[model samples]
Structure formats: structure tokens, C-alpha cells
Target: MPTLLKKGLALMLCWFVSSDLYALVILQYHHIDTETPFSTSTSPDRFTEHLALIEASGARVVRLEDAITRVAKLETENEIGPGPDAPAGNEAFQVAITFDDAFISIFRTVFPLLKARGWPFTIFVAPDLVETSAQYLTWDHLREMQRAGATIANHSLGHEHLLRLKGRQTDDDWMKRVSDNTREAERQLTMQLGGNRPLLYALPYGEYQPLIIERLHEMGYTIFGQQSGATSRSYETPKVHPRFPMGGPYSALESFRTKLSSRPLPIPHRLLDPLLGHAETRPSLSLHLPQSLTRTHRINCFGPSGALTIEPVGEGQYLIQTPAMLPTGRSRYNCTLKASDGRYYWYSQMWMRKLANNTWWEEP
Candidate 1:
């Protein structure tokens, strides 16, 4: 979109903003087939229903890179000054739909659906898998999608877990290899697409430690994670933007609506926990939330194992912990506050717990 048109559209969105900040919901999926792994696949029929719901909600379906740029601008404007910039009521939502791993189902099913509607979307692909695996997307499919308003971005070469070290690999070697993988993936995307592609990367299986995130940041990339939350002031700006999964059991229409209605909680600063835990799988999390929310006592934090107890420590800092240890692999601590309106202000901290030997238990 042109700069003039983009600004005009932003003015016309008329969203329900919280704390003078605009929000964008990024929804991600892997497969669009019923035959693929159920945990990572949304059937074609369910996906169609999801699109119908999105259209009904009157939300703007934008390409991935454009969504981030819009949010960045909104955040900057709100930070500088605040006023009647955002309306005091309901309006259309802003959502960016993305598919990860570039499965054939996306090229076959998802492409035609969105193409017919002439709506824009994004696909995060591991270039190494293109045409190499029958289940994955081919370069021709990518070219076709790219021609039809789809933004192709990096998902790392080989789609391997960045957190898990290979056999006999040293810590330094692993970090270097991971960084290389990311850079090479982006290079391949540019080589294949032959356009001014952005350095957008989605973590393979959404696995990353603080170190991995920092390395990617140093490389000048905007990272996307599989954590469930809205993108707004809550996100770490251009780094590690959280995305809601839209597959498997999470494919329910009501659940999707609730996520679309969600707002970013007030966590602009003071969350710096490295979500990598080994021995202490049941790790503790601390957050510095607004005192006004603590006073309301309506803020609730939950982990996948169970509801976590939010203990107020001091000076607007709260200790969040769950009784049950998270199962090996990825999990999240989700905090939500019911807003004056019916919708909830939400934030999620993604965690990855390795096995006792500090090795990932399962492959993505």
C-alpha cells in the first residue's frame, strides 16, 4: 500500500483502542489438510469457516509485513501524545493471517480461497524444503502465491529447532549455526522471490531462548512467535511478535472471535524472563503490571498445566507461578484482564522447557 493510502486506511479503521494504543491480531497456521498432523493442521472446511467469520467481523485482513508497520506507527504516535486519536467505542479489527512451513495444503487450498477474495496474506517458508519434500510447497507454488499478493518470508533453513543443539555441538557452535541458518534462510527468500523482501522470520516450532532472540535482533530481523496474544504496545516492538495459533483444537469459531476481540495488556516494559527452563520446568514468572490493574484484582494469569497463582510481590511487580510443571516442550503463561467493555485485555509469555538432559524431547 502507498504511504498516503495506508495512513488514510488507518484513520478509517475506527478500532476500539485500550490505553491509547491500537492492536493487531496475527493468526498463524501450518497445514490446511485433514490428513496432515492434526496438532498443526486446520481442515479446508474449517479454514473456510474461519475466513467467513473474519469477513463478518469487519476486520481488515492485511499482509504480514504491512500489519507490523501499521502497528509500529500507531504505537509511536500513541507514545508521543494522546488524545481523541482512538474512538471510545467499537470498530473494525485489524488482523494479519499467516501460514508457516509452506505446506502444499496452503498452495492448493488456502491460496485459491484468499486469491478468489483478493485478500492479502503471508507465508513463512523454509527455502530448503521447497521442492525437496512432496508434503511441502514447491518454488513454482511460491512464485504463483507471490504474484497473487502473498508475502513470502523466512522460517529458517530446514525448519529445525533453534534452541535444540545438535549432537556433540558446543554452545557457541550451536548459536553460530542457528544464526547462520536464519541469515541463509532470508538470503534464500530474496534469491527466490527477487523482490524487496523484508527480514521477517517465524521461529521454527516457535522455539527460542533469550539468546536466540537477541542474535536475531542483532541481524536486523522482526521475529514472530507462536504465543497467543494481540500485537500492540505489549509486543517487544520489531522483536518476537506473538501470534495466535489457528489449528487443531484451537480452531473453534467462538475461540477465534474471542481472540479477535482481545486487546493488548499494559506491559510496555519490565518483562525480561528467559523462557528456557530445564530442571526447573515449573519456572516462576514475574511481571510489572500497572498498579490500577492490581487494585482491580480482576487480572488472572494461567499456564497450560493449570491456573497460576498471581502473588503480588512489591512495587507493581507480581510473581506468577503454576503448581503443575509444564510438560516437556513449549507452553505459555497467559494473563488477561476483563476490560470495561466485554472484551479482555490479554498478554502471553511463551516458555520452552527442555528434558532433564537439556535436550528437546520431540521434533517439530
Candidate 2:
């Protein structure tokens, strides 16, 4: 009896430890106008309803910068200070509200509501668009929002997709197109706001290639992308932080709740691995599967020269042994899998670097 009791206590302790790594929801908004074809533009009344739902959820609303700062500090020091106005030890349930593009409506509509509630938010602006057109926020409006505690960030100069540049362009041309634009935008934002340059960047259209991500990192940006899902310990990357797009005509409170209650979409291993550039050096690869797969599944990793196969060792886990002759360097690899239910999944990521040891270690 005592042995059984001890085993039950150990299982409870394990559950407690696992539950401590709660997920963070970063909600993204763009435009907040009534006319955009995009389903994400939330009307003012609907946005307020969304806010009311968030409040009812008992989640603390934080700015994207604040959320990033909290995550970084937690990673570095293993602690997050008490959130402003948050209860002690309740930081895990925090949410970050972010707006992309300097829409005039955001300043005229959203900012007032946020300010009234004393809520924090992050706004990404394309410096070139500010104050130029009726659709975009003017510099005065942006400054007013900044004064009201909304953190402004750079969203590039022209909102161009950095990854779609012509392949024939010279390295200098590419750098000017990407780096120079960001630099100038930074300069303008600092000059207008009279504060330090914004460090956060939202990828245009939620699109980013690996090279663009590297360039943004070089330009001192620590966060990017528009992929939507709750962030947990396993999904850590500046290029693809999960953020649910909110505040559109279709962004009713019911829809928002449904999205929040849903589990993350299952990203295929084939689609995920190549983005990391791991195919060349470690010819073999493994994927962490969702918990519901009770039976083992086969994962196939294919390279230019040959193919390798992996099998699930346990639920949502697979192992692959690679060829010793696999050359080292950054190479894109593709993965495909067939589950027992006959559904096929595909994904890829970049493979870079070869480790001296093959032993598995826990990822931080």
C-alpha cells in the first residue's frame, strides 16, 4: 500500500511540474478598419467585445515588447517579475495584444479603448505610409498613441516581402533593399518619437524566408513572423512566434473563443524541418509528435542523394539514424509520414551544423 501511495504521489508531482510551463497567447491585429477584405480587420464594437472576452478569461493583457522582455528575462534569470497590476505568481496566463500596420482606425478607435482600460499594446508601423494617406495613421496620431502608452515598432519601409527579391540582385542591392530600409525606418521612428529605436519587427504579410530572418537578426530585431498558436517551451524562435490574428469583421467574440479553445494546428514534420536547415549535416532527423498518436508511425527523410527512414519509439516520438558520409553544411530536407489512419503529412526545414556527439539532450 505504501509503495502504491508513493507512486501516486510521484505521478502527481510530475503533473504539477509539467503544468507549470503554461502557454502564452499573443494576439495579432491589423487595420481594425471596416473595409479590408481580410477577415482580420475588427470593427470597433467587435474589438471591445473581444477585449471583454479576454478580460473575462482572466488573462492579463501585455504589450508584445513587454511579453518579449518577460520571456527573455525568464530565459536568462529563470524568473519573471510580477506584471504591473497582476497578482503575484500569476504571470503565466498573460497575453500580448499587437497591431500590425499604422492604420488610422487603430489610433482613432482602438487606442482610445485601450487607453481607457489602461491596457498595453504594441503597434508595428511602416514608416513610409505614416501620415501620407487617409488609410494610414498620421505622425501626430502615432505620437499621440505613443504618449498614451502604446509601444511603436518598425514594420519595414514599404511593407515588401524581404524574401521575394529578385535572385539576380547583387548582395549589396539586397542589403540596401532590406537593411537600409530598416535602418531608415528606425531613424524616422526614433526622430518622431524621441526615444530609442524600436527593436520589434513584424514580417510583412506574416511571410519570412530563412535569409530574411537572418538579416532581421543582424539588424537587431529579436522577434518576427505571423504564425498563430499558443507559445510553449518547445516552440521558441523569433522568426515564427505564434500569434492569433484578431479584430476583423469575422473576428466576433465567439470566433475568438473558439480559436482560443482549439489546440494548435498540427504542423507537418516535413514542413517544419527544412525551415531549420537540418537536412545536410544530420542526414537523420526526428520529430516530436502530438500526444494522441497511440501507435507507432514511420517517418521518411529524403535527401538529394538518398533516403532514410525513421520509426516512432513512443507516442509522438521518432528516431532516425543517418549515413556517416552525409556532408556537412546548410541544406534543406523534406519529411513525409503516413499514419496508421492513412493520412499523409508533409513538412521541411533547413539542416545546419553537425554535432560532435549524437546523444540527445533536452532542449532549453
Candidate 3:
């Protein structure tokens, strides 16, 4: 073989050998404009800075589905997008860019930036909002995006809270209702975009029950939740992934760089405690040190208020306790430890509780 060909083969071998170790850090955005709600908006200027920083970080920007396949171990790389001519992707962490809600700013601003770099992205569209509102993207805009190598996937028909149920509805009744909406939203994408888009769903308001996940899994949909983590092969949920929210002040480049480079904390499948509880309920999160981890002295677990209590039980087990009862609504117990590589291994456990009257609380 020629010298270049020989180098190519060697790189290919390296990719295959280390493929299992790859991690995906998916960045989730809702609106890329300054005018929308700040809680869900990143300024267009900040988004441009984000793109520059992403390029500087040296992380591979991949399509969401392709990243999922690699990190979830769903398919060999050959089955996804890389070819022999493609750079061997084993060394750098992969990042996927996703915009929820199909906002017009994404079409006006984000699409061109991504397209110029030849990077692929996924847009989770809520069909009911599109074309009906001035803020949201239209069907024609979606089709244009699809033609320009973007994925327009399902965010549900109306973007309603799938977990919220009517007073008289059973869980079975709720599932049927939400599932029908999901299916119809997908149908709209197929009809409008004229392609078989992947079955990817983002939970609205970042709320989910175990039953909701079970049903969506049965429906053959891969889920992305509004949470924080570096999704890895060791993720507890194979089909459901967590995404780092990139909106409001959190879109600042400093926080962005930290999360962009963070590693996934090792967690097992099927964590049964507090991922919610009753209002004002204190929840305990128990976990063990990763097998490769040694010297647990630098470990830190943070809660909504401040630093949490981490008690080391016998063996490698430890229990993290919150300092106070979490306020009603959604919260995350984020634990981080500095690894030998100087990057933090991050794990976020979501907790949610309804108001005293059983009404939902708005995110503050």
C-alpha cells in the first residue's frame, strides 16, 4: 500500500478498537434569538460564539441519530455515516446540535451557520405551532431545511405536556392520547418533508414518568430529555438520552465549554429512586464509584440550594443527600468528580413534584 493508504488503514483500526469508549455530548437549544423567552433563548450573537467555540473545542459535530447509534452501540460505524475517507473519529468526543420547537430563529440563523460548515443537525418540530405562529418555522421552511441536510423530527403534535393527564383519565387513556399525537406529528413530518425521518422525541417541559418511557420505548422511539450529561455507552437508558440545555444565561461560553468537555458519570441501568418525589420531600441518591475510579476525595454532589452531603458507606458505595427539601417542580442532583484527565465526570438526576393542589409548577 502507498504511504497515505497505509496511514488510513492504521487510523481505521484505531477507530474500531476505541469506538466503544466514545461519549456524546448533545447540546439542546430551543430558540436562537434574543427576542423570544430568555429561559429558552440563546442570542444569535451568542450562538455564533458557540459555533466558534465548538470548532475550537475539536469535538466532532455529528447528526443526532448517528451520534446515538455510535454511543448507544446500536450499529457499527460502517452502518452509520463514516467512510474510509472520513477522518477516524475515535479520539475526540462527539457533539450533536439539536434545536427544539422549530423556532424561526433556527431557520433564519442556526440553519445557515450549520450548513456553511457542512454539519448536520436535528430539529424537533411541534407540528401544531408551525405556520400558525410568527415565531415558529413554517412547513415550507422545514422542507427547505430538509433539502439542505437537516432532520425535521417529531416534538409532538401540539408540544403539550405528555405526562400531564386529565382528571378522569387513567394512565392507559393518557398513553393512548399522547401516543396518538406523537404518531400524527411524525406523519406530518413525513408528508411535509417527503422522507422517512427518524422517530426521535423530546419530552416537553422535561417531565417523564417511568410509564411514559416504557410506552415510548414500546412505540420504537428514541427519546431526548432536557437534562444535563455526557451521554455514553454506559448510559442507563439505551434509547433515552439526556441533553445539556443551551439557553438563557447558561448559553454563556464559559458554562458551555465546561459542559461541552465534561465526561459522563458512570451510572447503571434502572435507577429506582428520585429521578421525583412529593413536594418538599428530601430525596437520597445512592451510587458507587466507577471501577476505574480511585481516590474519591475530590467528589462533589450539588443540589438546588448548594453542596449536598455525600456519605461513603462500606465498599465503593456512597449516598448523596440533599441539604433541604427541594421546592415543588423539577430539580436535578448534579454530581461531578474531577477525573485524571482533568475533565469532570458529570451525572444529573432529575427530581420533580407537583404543587399541593396537584397542579403543575412552571419552571422558574
Candidate 4:
């Protein structure tokens, strides 16, 4: 009724609405066992703590598909706040849990916990390994999980580094092989899981080049990468939708909370394409940050070694040169900045280096 009281209420509502506009994070997991190589595994106790923390945080845990659809719609329609179909109290921070590789631990461990909470998740499976690998989930196991509110999506046929071309494999041959591999996986999944699943793709080993992404785009599939950043409406296409990996050291509660609150750093669309380091194995990256992120002084970039060299290229743009040619493995360059709200804005790009004529790669 009073003018001053009405103005105060309006300001609070505006703050709430704006904050909810960018409230989304996608977390990727691999294994949840203490015995299965700690690099990709998180101890069961830690995993339990993770779920408990999410439950107590007052944040909604949504299905991966729901989060993706909402973000795509938000970017296209430019609508903010809860939509007409949105449920009550959904206009807050949200998270989507996704597991890759379809490890046995998923069905044995992670699936049960998620099921108990009545939460939804997505699992990316390499169809070729379903029955071949003893450690992987079998078709029956996956089918049961799917029946229990899980989304089964394609990771690839064999989960090979999709960007690496075999010896004497020409560009055309590589393209055909990749296309066939992807198509075969889709066929296999369709035969088993029915035709109602979403065409979501998770890159194997978190590696990809611009051309590979372009080819995937042409094939009509939604893509997700293992880069360490928060996904948002700005990343409307699957090509650049970054999902933070949550395993091993990253599964700790403190780090998990920080990552859960992370925001997507402003990266221009043209400059956001996947950059691959071919012969050099280590490539420099240039970024043109959005003007809204004026805290340039707080921006920091780091690689596998440590802090990287960040040199100003021009107004609101910087060049990050890697310190060394990355070893023959998966490495990433991560950038984070201090947001006005005290949470960090994050962005990451992954690199997969291959040895030249190296026997290690030729082994069966």
C-alpha cells in the first residue's frame, strides 16, 4: 500500500529474478569406487557426502535433459524466472548429475543413491564395451537403470579419442570411420533402449577439435564436453556446452560447493570454438571477454603445470600461452574470475596430445 514499501519489495524481486537467470551447473562423474584407480574414482563415503550436501543446500537437483532444455529455451526466447509450467520454488540454483562410461559402479552404487533421492541422471555408454568389458555395465543392467528414471545416451562406439586418426588413416577415411562408429552406437542403443531417448553426446576423454565438433553438429546430436566450467543459456548449442568433471580430488565437499556456485565466464561465440594442438601439442589461446566482467585484474588462468602467462592482446582480449608442450595425455587450461557476488566465474578448455609415430599408441 505504501510507496516506499512497494519499491523495496520490487527491488528484492528483481534481484531474485536476475540471480535465478544464470543459476545452472552440470557435473560429470566417472567411477564411484575406492579400488578402481583413484584418478577417476571417488570413494563411496565422499560420494555419499556429496549427495547429502546437495540435498541440504536447498538447491534443486534436476534431470540433465530438463536443464539442457531450459537453458536452450532461455537463450532462444530470452525469458527469465520460472515459466508458466515451472514448479514452485524452482527459481533457484539447479544442478544436473551425469555419469560417463557406464561403469559397473554406476548401477551398483551411484544409481541406488540417486534412486533413493528420487533424482534423475544421465549415463553415457560406449555401446561396444557393454558386453565385452567385465567392468562395464551390461545391457540388462543399463535397461534396469533406464527403467528407474535414468537417461541412457551415447558416448561413442568404443570410447576412443575421437579426434585421433589412426596410422595411414586419411582425412576422408577418418571421417567415415567416425561417422560409422557414431551411427553404429546410435543403432545399437536404439535397438536396446527404444527410440524415445535424447540424442545427447559426451565426448570421450574430453577431447575434440573444431572440425570434429562441426561434423558432430552436422550429424544432429547434442554434444557435451569435460571442460571445467558451468553451463548456461549462452552455450545454447551442444558444441560448447561445458560440464565440470566431478571425480577424485574434485569430489571433495568444499570444491564441490565452489564448483556448484560457479558461473560461466563471458566468452564470445566466435572465439569459443574447440582449438586443437596438432604437431606442437601445446597451443596458445586468445579470449575476448565480455565487457560486463570488468574485474579483469582478478582474472587468472592456469594449466597442468601452474599459472600460465596471460598477456594483454588488446582491449578486453588476452593471449594465454602454454608454458610447455603438453605431454601425451589429457590436460586442461582453466580460467576463473572473481564475480561481484564473491563466487567465481569459471571457464576451461581441454587438450589431448598424441605422440608422433609412437609405439605406445600402436599397441593393441
Candidate 5:
């Protein structure tokens, strides 16, 4: 009887943990060179080691497009069976590998390594950079990589930040910019490769306003962000997908290991919602907990000021009744749940005002 009771407890804990497990990692890379200011560039040897580590860990390397498709299928309002390529079991984890900026080294070095391992990756390219022999990927090299099983996606024409430019010349300026860039890239790629035009785009520098995102969507491009988080069925948003940037000075193999092994960290409340203002009105969030822990579990909603204790309403769901209305300015907030089983989960998001106009705008 004692052994039976222990097994029951273990099963209960597993259920509790699995109930909230929703995350998928997406790793992003740019150049893999060895130059100053580009120290984040992975040497060919280090790159090989990285691939070996991923292989040994038994992690699946998916393309960015595949990742998007999986998340979209999972986010469907009503779906019975698993979408294409999803694991038979719902608990399986997935990781996607993506490269941005269409670096020459990616074609020469990364492509060969991935081909040998039979791995899939997505490369976001700036069409203008192709065949220039000017510090960017050439069309010939890109075609070779694509033939080797890599998917090439759009990253705009000049790789410029699409946000932060506004006013008089904005509308005409941005429409031309977006159209010319996207069309030229699409035309060149189609003429050369005879494949479907890439419908996905990565925001340069991960900076974009709501207007910019809307414009990209209007242009038939699914937007991707450089935010640090994990993708999942629950957290599916076309305009703000998560990506882990892998080309920073502080990013080492150990760091990569930690990223691969650990789950996505929750966004801190302070960073999401600042204490100085009221900015939570735009996107109000609530936590719904399972009924298993009616008496012992509590939900804590944290902000820049401090923790806001939320009282349980029903089952495991908690209601946060703010003392003051959320401000109109930009803000962010984080949520944490301390369960009776001694485990917790964290999440955060930023809330900001939408743009006034719907017209296209450029980053000048």
C-alpha cells in the first residue's frame, strides 16, 4: 500500500507539470565568420561542434517555415488530430534552426554541414545582396544551398528596420520601399529557382511597430521577431514569433547548451509593466488554473512595483483586480503560479498602443 501511494503521488506530479508545459525553441543565427565585432560568428570548427551537440541531444532541427506551420496548426480554434509533422504524443519538444541576413559563409560553410547531417534550416535573405560579391550572399551560392535542402525566406530588400520612420513622405515612401523590395526579391528567386515565393519575413533588428507588421502581412509576408522566448501552441502570433539570437559576444557553447536544455524563462514583470505608469489596459491577461489544487495553490501577478496577490475564483483560476486602471502608455507584466506541488511557471508580455494610421511606413 505504501508503494502504491508513492506511485500515485508521482503520477499526480507528472500530470501537474505536463498540464502547463507549452514551449518550442527557435534558434537564430546570422554570420559564422571570425572577424572583429563579429566575434559571435561561429568558426567552422565551433559550428561543427554545435551541430554535434544538437545531434547528440536528440533534438530535432526544423526549418522556420515548418515551425510556423506547426504553431499555426496548433493554434487553430478547433482541431481534432495533430497537424502535419507534429509528434504522435503531445508532450514532445521541438527546436527550429534559422539563419538571417543571407551571409556568404552560411552558403559555403553552414550549408555543407547541414546537408551532411540531413538537417533542415531556413535562411532569410535580402534579395539585393544576392550576386553582388559585396559582402553578401551570391545568387549562385544561394541556389546551391537551396538545392541542398535549405529553405530561403525573405528578409526585406535592404535589411533595413521597417519601423521608426513616420510623417509626410512616409506613406508613398514606405509603399514603394515595401513593394519594390519584396517584388524584386520574389521575381529574382522565382526566375532563378522556379519555386514558390517565400511568404515569411524576419524583421531586421527585431524592431517593428504594429503598422510595420500590418504592412508586411498586407504584402503577404508572415512576420517574425527576434524576441527571446519559446514558441508554442498557446503562444502563437504571426507578427511576434519568438527567436533566440545566437550571434552575441556573451553567447558561448555553454550558453547554447543551457538554452537547449532549459525551458523558456518567463518575462519579468518589471520589464513588461513599469511602475511609473498605467499601461496594462490594452491586453489584459488572466490565469486559469486546474481544479486539482483548489486549496493550496496561489497565483501571483508581478509588475514593476511588486507582486499583486490574486485570489482564487474557481478551480485553479485566479482573478487579478487592479486597484487602478491600466495606463495608456507602453507597459509589460509577468505572471507566476506557485502550485501546491512546489512547482511554478512564468510568462510575460508587453502592452502598447496601436498605430494611428494603416498606411505603409519605412524606417529612414
Candidate 6:
């Protein structure tokens, strides 16, 4: 082989050797406007910069379906499958873009820019909100976007917190309601969009419990939540797959860069529970990592308050406890282990508080 061809082959061999370690980072966005009511809105200008930075970073932007399928396949197979947008020969770090709630701003601002980039994305919409809320995207808008290469999935009927039940609502009734709401959303999306509804489910408010997850699993839905973590082969969940939420303060390009460059830490399933209960804030999160990770001392876990307390339990097992009671709403414990090469291995667990102890879940 010529000198240049020989160099190319050597690089390819290196990629092949390390392909199993590659993970997918999924970035979640909610709105693309400056004045949206929710704190989860990314300004249009910042949204534009996000796309530019993602493109400049040389990360392969993939559809959400492709990411899920690729990660699921990677769990069983050692090789990464060449999905819709992935190149067959290279082991590139993949990033997928997703927007929840189907904001009109997404259609007005985000769609044009992403369409120009020739990129594919997924949008989860609550049909009830779309029907009644003027701020949300209408069925026609979603249909147009879908025709233009966006995949529309189910968020829920009214974006209610699916895990919580009313004060008097029995557990069986709550489960029945949740099931009906999801089926209704899927049915409406299929009716309006003229295709089979995608199995993708973005949990409303990024909150889920074991009961909720079990219900969703029975319905054959692939769940994605707003937790921060990279999805890798070792990341297996028939319940909830995590996507890093990027909105409001998180939309800054620097934070985006750090999140985009992070890798998934192979955490055993024992520590994967959501750990939610009434008035319970500080839950214990224990992780047992493989021995191959030699930087256990350098691993740091952080909550909304700051650095958490990490205690060594045994060989390759550590106990991480939240330093304070997590206030109401959704908060996460984010841990990162810095590698020698400067990349960080990431893991996160989400904690949710019921809206009120007396009545229906409180809205904070």
C-alpha cells in the first residue's frame, strides 16, 4: 500500500479495536425562544450556536431511533451497527438531538436551521397540549415537520406527571389512567400523522418510578428521561433510558461541550433505581464499577447542592449519599470520573418529589 493508504488503514485498525468503548450522548432541548414561560427554554440565538458547536465538534448527529437501536444492539454485540446516519467504517462519537413538548418555537425557529443542516431529530408531543395550548405546536405543524424528516413521538395526553396519583385515587385507578392516557396519545398521533406511532416515550417532567416504568414496559415503549448521562452498551434499561437535558442555563456552549464530550460509566443495575418516595429527599446511591476503571479515587458525584459524600464500601463498590435533602421537583445526582486522556465518564440518577403530601402531586 502507498504511504497515505497505509496510514489510513492503521487508523481504521485503532478505531476497530476501541469501538466497543464508544457511547452515545443524547442532548435534550425543550424550547427555542427567549421568553418562554418554562425555565427549560433555550433562546433562539443560543440554539443556533448549539448547532454550530455540535457541527464544529465533529460529532455525528443521529436520529433518536438510531441511537436507541445502536445502543441496544451494542449491549449484545461487540460491533456498532451502521444505522441510518452512521458511517459503516468509522468509530465516531455519536450525539442525538431531541426536543420535548412540541413548542411552536421549535417549528418556527429550530426546524429551519436543522432542516438546512440535513439532520434528523425526534420530537415528543402531548396531544392534549397541542390541541388546547396556543404555545404548543398544532397537529398540522407537527405533520409538516414530520414530512420534512422529523420523527414525532408520544409525550403523554396532557404532559401530567404519570408516576403520581391523586390523594384519593387508588393505585389501580392511577395505573389505568396512565395506561389510557398513553394509548390515547399514541392513537391521536397515529391518526393525525398518518403512520404508525413511534414507540419512543419521553416521560413528562423527566419523572418516573418503578411502577411507571413497569407499566410502560408492558406497553412495549422505549422510555427516555431527562437525566444526564451517556448511553453505552453497558447501559441497559427496559424502563428508562437517559438523555442529558439542555435548556435554560444548560444551553450555554461551554456546558454543552462538556456534556457532549462525556462518556458512559458502566454502572451495575443495582444502583439504577429512581429511589422516589413521599418526603424522602436524600436517597442512598451505591455503585459497583468494574475493576478496569482504575480511577475510582478521582470519581466525584454532584447533586444540585454541590459535591456529594462518597464512601468506599468494598473493592470496586462505593456509597454515594446526597449531602442535603433535595428540594421538591426533579433533581439529579451527576457523577463524573476523569480519564487520563481528558474525557470524563458520566453517570446520573434522578430524584423526584411529589407535588403535595395532601392532594394531587403539587406543581412547583
> Could you tell me every candidate's TM-score relative to the true structure?
0.86, 0.66, 0.86, 0.85, 0.65, 0.86
User: Which consecutive 10 residues in model 6 have the weakest lDDT in total?
Assistant: 81-90
Please, what are the lDDT tens digits per residue for candidate 4 over residues 1-364?
Answer: 9999998876544443343336578888899898897778888898898888888877789887788777777666655554211232544468889999999999889988999999999999999889777789999999999999899998999898776653478877887777888899999999998888988888887767776666676788778888888766643443657887877778878888888777666454442444443475657888876544543346799898888888887766889877876665567889988765556778887766556654223322
Error of 6 at 187 (Å): 0.4
Runs in model 4 deviating more than 4 A are: 1-23, 79-92, 165-167, 234-238, 270-282, 295-297, 356-364
Query: Which digits, one per residue and each the tens of the lDDT, describe model 1 over residues 267-291?
Result: 6443344546587767777787655
* lDDT of predicted model 5: 0.59
Identify the superior model by lDDT, candidate 2 or candidate 5: 2
lDDT of 6 by residue, 183-235 (tens): 99998888899765568899998887677777887888888888888776533
Judging by TM-score, tell me the better candidate of 1 and 4. Answer: 1
**What would you estimate as the lDDT of candidate 6?**
0.76
lDDT of 3 by residue, 321-358 (tens): 89888878888888887755556677788888677766
Local distance difference test, each candidate: 0.76, 0.61, 0.75, 0.75, 0.59, 0.76
- Of the two candidates 1 and 2, the one with more favorable lDDT, higher being better, is 1
Q: 5 or 6, which is superior by TM-score?
A: 6
At residue 72, candidate 6 shows an lDDT of 68
Once model 2 is optimally superposed onto the true structure by TM-score, how far is the C-alpha of residue 360 displaced, in angstroms? 40
Worst 10-residue lDDT window, candidate 5: 268-277
lDDT tens digits, residues 1-364, model 5? 6999998886554343342234466778887777624534666676677788888767677776776666566445423332212232333356778888887788778887888888888888877777666567887787878887788887777776454344457676876676666677677667776676458778776665665666667776766666555555432333556566777553578766645543333221121221122223334455554444334444557644466546666666566544444434333455644433233433444444332333333322
In angstroms, the error of model 1 at 105 is 1.0
Clashes of each: 0, 24, 0, 0, 5, 2
